[model samples]
Target: MPLPAMPIETDLLLAHLNGQRQHVLGILDGLDEDALRRPVLPSGWSCLGLVRHLTEDVERFWFRCVMGGEPTAIVALSQGTEAWQVDPDVPAAVVLDRYRQEIDRANAVLAGTPLDAPPAWWPPDQLGDWRLASAREVILHVITETACHAGHLDAVRELIDGRTWLVITT
Candidate 1:
């Protein structure tokens, strides 16, 4: 079958991404400290860790590093993978707030950019210049990344409480 005409790709992308975003948040809803902190993987990442990591990395990598042409990528923790490690002392609620704020900042960056244009360029914290990507590609990448993580959280939530965010209706 031929693809349906899409007048604006960005709007379609944002809609689908936001839908997945909601599910990620939904899985975290009503969870107490134990549920949020319980490790679902042998690697020891909890639900809270996934949320916190996404909160910081989304904006820094996509907006600042790629779109704004900044070299040094700012993250929740400068220590790379440790960014996904959660500190149990902090409330899961706080991490969600930070995620929302970063998303607002990211949205502003998207609003001001022309999707097809060459992304801004700077130099080095980790990324090579060869990895430069366009605004459109970055948006799609963010959506894909968010959706992928949401799937992880879905499994984590189910393992923690035997509950799921998905439903099937015929």
Candidate 2:
């Protein structure tokens, strides 16, 4: 069956955000289980662990918990789970799949929301005076954070096997 065309009136901020998300995933491509789970840097964060962090802290935290006011995400946040520490028993595929699923849910929240809309919930206790007043701010924040982590992944992937996300020839 033929696929439907994407809607013409797409959100510009969302486009950038999704691009960064894809960039993160792209940097993780072609890595084996050991490579994905190996901590190349001194910080001790694996690629899969970074993906898990993005899934929980960035996507689910911003869109589901703060913007959409999802109770499960709220409770999860309250418990302060360490999103960047993946257990040995957890497969790399599981972490990647969870990130993809969280992206889908985050997109759902973004679809019904206006850029100017205030977040439905905020962690006043945890954040203290810090705040993101609108959906636009949140999206921009996520995009920035995702892009930063994508660069981190690019460096890590290169250290793993000399892979680069992009190359320029002059």
Candidate 3:
């Protein structure tokens, strides 16, 4: 896909960053609770779990880390000691909507901010007199974080069913 454009073309970095989100969207789109909550491999991570993790991650890293100047102390709720604590009572629909919306919000922030804009969360040195990153770096950060999750989601998706993202033509 050519990528969806806003009023401005933020450049290749943003496009690449958005691509990772698109990858995640592909993993999420058609899943229901049965498919989303199914376990994969050695860990207990599920499609829904992955979405939750990504949603929090996107907010912490993109919205907080970059835009709001906050920290990323929030860990994945499904990881390590907390793995077994996920509330089974939670509905998949709510989780999915929240995840999708957070991702869209992150995209909106990236689109609205200039690539060279200084994120409130950046280190003081980086945000110094001539601070602010090249638009490419911010997008690159988003891409790297999101792509790793996308990879994990892809595997989780495959484990849930037999689907591979590459297998679908559309």
Candidate 4:
């Protein structure tokens, strides 16, 4: 999706997020399994690690945290190491697939619920802070998170092989 140069909502936010997704997708495309899993930075964070983390983060916000209470006990703890070892034995491709699944689920939940519908999950105190958000706000948070991680992945790509960011879609 083509993104706008301005900071407007709706189209701008959606377009920007689509752009970020494209950017990350580009970084992942045409890479071997090793390349995808390789640590491209000094801290050993790989493209796969960032993808997994972003997926989980957004899932928490949009699905469990934003909509309801924590559904599972599997919490993400970043050690900033090679491949991020979420479940050390899992492969990069597996993590990426999990991310894709979570994103779809989160999107569906967000699309089905109204923005003003009271969140089913947060604590009473947290409720006050979140009570007023529209669905737009929730989506904006997702976009912001995705864009931030896309930038991180871009830097990792550059570090790995001096790759530059180019538009993925016109």
Q: Give the range of the ten consecutive residues with the poorest summed lDDT in model 4.
A: 1-10
Q: Which ten residues in a row have the lowest lDDT in candidate 2?
A: 1-10
Q: In lDDT terms, how accurate is model 2? A: 0.85
Candidate 2 regions with alpha-carbon error over 4 angstroms: 1-10, 74-81
Kindly list the per-residue Cα lDDT of model 3 for residues 21-49, writing each as its tens digit: 78987876688777777776566666776
lDDT of model 2 at position 47: 91
**lDDT computed for candidate 4:** 0.63
Q: How close is every model to the real structure, measured as TM-score?
A: 0.84, 0.89, 0.69, 0.69
Better of 2 and 3 by lDDT: 2
RMSD of 3: 6.0
Best by lDDT: 2
lDDT of 2 by residue, 72-135 (tens): 7842442443677799999998989999999998988888777788999887688779999998
**Model 3's TM-score against the true structure:** 0.69
Which residue segments of model 4 deviate by more than 4 Å? 1-16, 68-70, 77-83, 123-134, 167-170
Q: What alpha-carbon RMSD in Å does predicted model 4 have with respect to the real structure?
A: 6.4
At residue 128, give the lDDT of candidate 2.
79
The residue pairs found clashing in candidate 2 are none
- Provide the overall lDDT of each model, using Cα atoms, as 2-decimal numbers: 0.74, 0.85, 0.65, 0.63
